[model samples]
Target chain A: MKKITLLTLSFTLSLSLILLTTGCAPDAKSHTGGAESLDSGLPSENIDATSILGAESGIAQAARPDGINPETDVDYSILSTETVYFNYDSFSIRSSERAKLEKIAKWLTDNSGKRLMVSGHTDTRGTLEYNRGLGERRALAIREYLVGLGIAQDRIFTISYGEERPADTGDNENAHSLNRRAMPGVITK
Target chain B: MRSQYDLNSMTKKLYTVLFAASLGALLSSSLFAIEVEVSGTKKIAVQISAFQGADAALAQKIVTEDLRRTLMIDPVVSQGSYSVAASVSGGSLNGKLTDTARGSEVFSRTYSGELRKMAHEFSDDILESLTQVKGFSTSRVAFISGTQGAKELYTMDIDGANIKRLTSDKSISANPSWSADGSSIAYMSYRSGYPDVYVIKLAQGIRTRVAGFPGINSGPVFSPDGQQLALTLSKDGNPEIYTISTSGGSPTRLTRTRGTETSPSWSPDGKQIIFNSDERGSNQLFTIASAGGEPIRITTPGTYSAEPCWSPDGSKIAYSTRTGGGFCVWVYDIATRVAKQVSPGLAEDPSWTCNSRHLVYSNNGSLYLLDTVTKQSARLDNGLTNCTEPAISR
Candidate 1:
């Protein structure tokens, strides 16, 4: 319990540090006066520091184009799952995804006798047919990890929604990164 | 935001050697008079003439060289059955212009006195050979040529004579792709500030806008049956291939993508279309079912390729590839996936005749007729006639 709390605190701190360093980066470099800074690496914050917002704010941008509604923000808990993803115009997962797959296998190990559906999603880009293929590859990658953990491929049905159901709708890259990630769902017994 | 480019490259060289007819009409246009010859028969022997003045021998040599170059551009010699350019010492101009319309008219340039004289004789023999199947001797090339930096569509004989303007507009008019029957020509013009497809009848001078989208509506190819026309349009916010009924109506989208698609070439049967696309991270040739489905790629390598025209027999496909710092014309054999390089210089925008034997294209400042079977070629006219797109009719 203590370890989880500590990790959560550090994750928040890292994000805040990232925002502070990036947000203030442009102002810090104003030494070259009167020039508009062109650095695109800056982080944009939606609400105040003390305010908490929805865990999944990616797709909410369609309704709240102005950004997160801090006062009305509802926090839906997000249970982290380390599902792997594929590369652009490719279906094969890379070596970098091995770590994520191991973590996912451990999750299935801890929660034994549980049913799960490995749903996959791709970011909105490329052709519809191509993206669908991409989603299937992503799902298959996750399924392959579970199968390596001795889980039957048939036991875990996979579904691919190629960029059709994006977790985020904001045009910004931060939202897109959050949406590119894959999450897990434990089916009821 | 979308664009497509395709290239057809032959892995192995085929038909590496070719030659043109040997006759006085073998060349056309210029001083030594080699460039003035056109439309040769089985073999037209071009005679190198000594200049009236200095360096008579050198001038004769110069004319011979230019004669070969001119023969390289003549459609009849460049693309037809077979022709060879061999210089001769002497010959008389016996060809006469029987077609009265050949008088200084754009179409008459195809009937230049010297060219007509040669065309008349060879066309007779060629007509005899043509009658075996049907000769294209009298057939002319309708193309878009420019002068004073402004272009207008024109038609002339394969000899590059009797050039006449078809569309006299202040704006640019180009790519005069003729229909199979030789009765009408479809081309692109910017008279409306945006490129649009316009079809003009030969004898009646009836001009009709076949396609005009809000954006680019150009590169129209008449189906073999002439019932449908395939074209490229950017109306959907990006360039993509589309088709419409020839009689005129709404268009049917053939491709949906982020990549721009243009330069649509229909198959001889009109059941398929080979197009240029960058869908695979680079510009390459791709074919799609005429009704629209998955596209099968044909060309494997090359970053720049475009403007594909299907052979009349549907046995092969001709396209342009960026080579040697300029686009060179090549033909791809569909069944074997083999390509044969035809054009010796920068060439693009290939359009074929009903015979499917020769291809008309443009390089540098003039149009050229490239014979896939013969190595012969010919320059269209002078620099005043900046020919880019050449379409020949049966």
Candidate 2:
């Protein structure tokens, strides 16, 4: 009995020692990783927190009604909103933009024969390839949302322009926010 | 007797555990081993002697500028550690590099081409002789230079000379991929009122429609072997990376993820591809076999990384990551899994020079070179505005 007890005690102590060493290993790795991040000069957080003002100003301009006027030849009011704007580096539909997407969904339902193309775009801030991906996500998010609202998936097509097409030419935050959007266009064929 | 046997078995087990633990430590420590030296940022000095014959001044001036743009060397007025002498006669030029410090001839070669092209060749040869590194002087940078509304494909010499507009499609053109031989460039344009991938053979200026799928056809990159092109297409639903023969056959899908995937860069071995995907909600780097398989995410948490270009040595992946205020060029060491930002400014679209020591990226409508070891960024002087999407040949 004594021998068995001793064995259990030794095993527990050994297990704890191994656990402690293994736990400490990750800490050391994370410490070096933290140092590398600092050394890379890419501060994880915003360097100039004031840059938010520029972005917010851009968002404010996004509220303006321009860039997507209905063609005088067209008779339908299919698009209540010509474009759906997204936040920086995000594809999640803003709560405020949900209603506009619903209207687009209703219009698509009304015109079953018509096809809509959602072309995604991004601000000039991120890498071109990433922005293209982000743009696609934005367009997909809208497509998925419209599909959820009973719009046929076949009626909707999506494309991501990345940063190739920007609605605003300025480099300021206002322009960037305006540029990061998904424009729903009527496609023939 | 039974107790004695039990004790012996326990001892054997303990020895086995000890052996395994030590082996694991040994394996892991070596696996994570990385040697990153913060090397000298100082430029190597080289003297460009006046060319002896025809196109002498032009040849001398371009070679001097070419070396200066390296961000690794400077042009000295007199003799330095290295000196280059060239003689241009007719369309042929002979250039020689001498190591002044050792008073020994390094290399001598004759190149036959245009006046400017011959000078570029000499600059590249001299650079290779001095540093044992391939020079980008003779390489061309294909990029998009225009407003967001109006964009076109433009090619310029690495020294920012010989600005040639390759496309007049009067539509948006983005993501120019240079061929391995530097004879052609492939890019996606909207000339057909939709995105279509086109290859422009530089010498003959012949444009071939390689891909015009039903949906998105963008981010076309030539494979290392030059036989296949990896690009992003949304024809099947979401944007995913696919590989198609440059000769225009059906594309074989590489990534099956529902997430958007773009910017596929080939590994030097042509066995794997590194591309950007938002599988985790934000953009990150992922690698998949060129033949198609499960992808392995390469980047760590904290930043949005994209546009990955694998190094020629396959030791690192140079990409642009979203930093605090802007994007910066960073290199992710494959062995250590450690990322080091090499550019200090807002830079994007990084492509490695053939030497793999330096990368050229665009910052604020201009292109710059960043040395991975020294972490020095120098602007490439082409004097063009809104130059982005820089693709370096070799």
User: Which docking class does model 1 fall in?
Assistant: incorrect
The digit string of per-residue lDDT tens for model 1 on B105-211 reads: 11111222333344333333332332232334455777766642357888886655566778777666765666767777888776654457888877898998888
Q: Retained native contacts per candidate, as fractions?
A: 0.00, 0.17
True contacts kept of 1: 0.00
Q: Which has the greatest TM-score?
A: 2
- The positional error of residue A34 in candidate 2, measured at the CA in angstroms, is 15
Q: Taking the tens digit of each residue's C-alpha lDDT, what string does model 2 give over B243-273?
A: 9998887999887654667889999999999
**By how many angstroms RMSD does model 2 differ from the true structure?**
12.1
**B-chain TM-score of model 1:** 0.68
- Which 10 successive residues of model 1 chain B have the least lDDT summed? B103-112
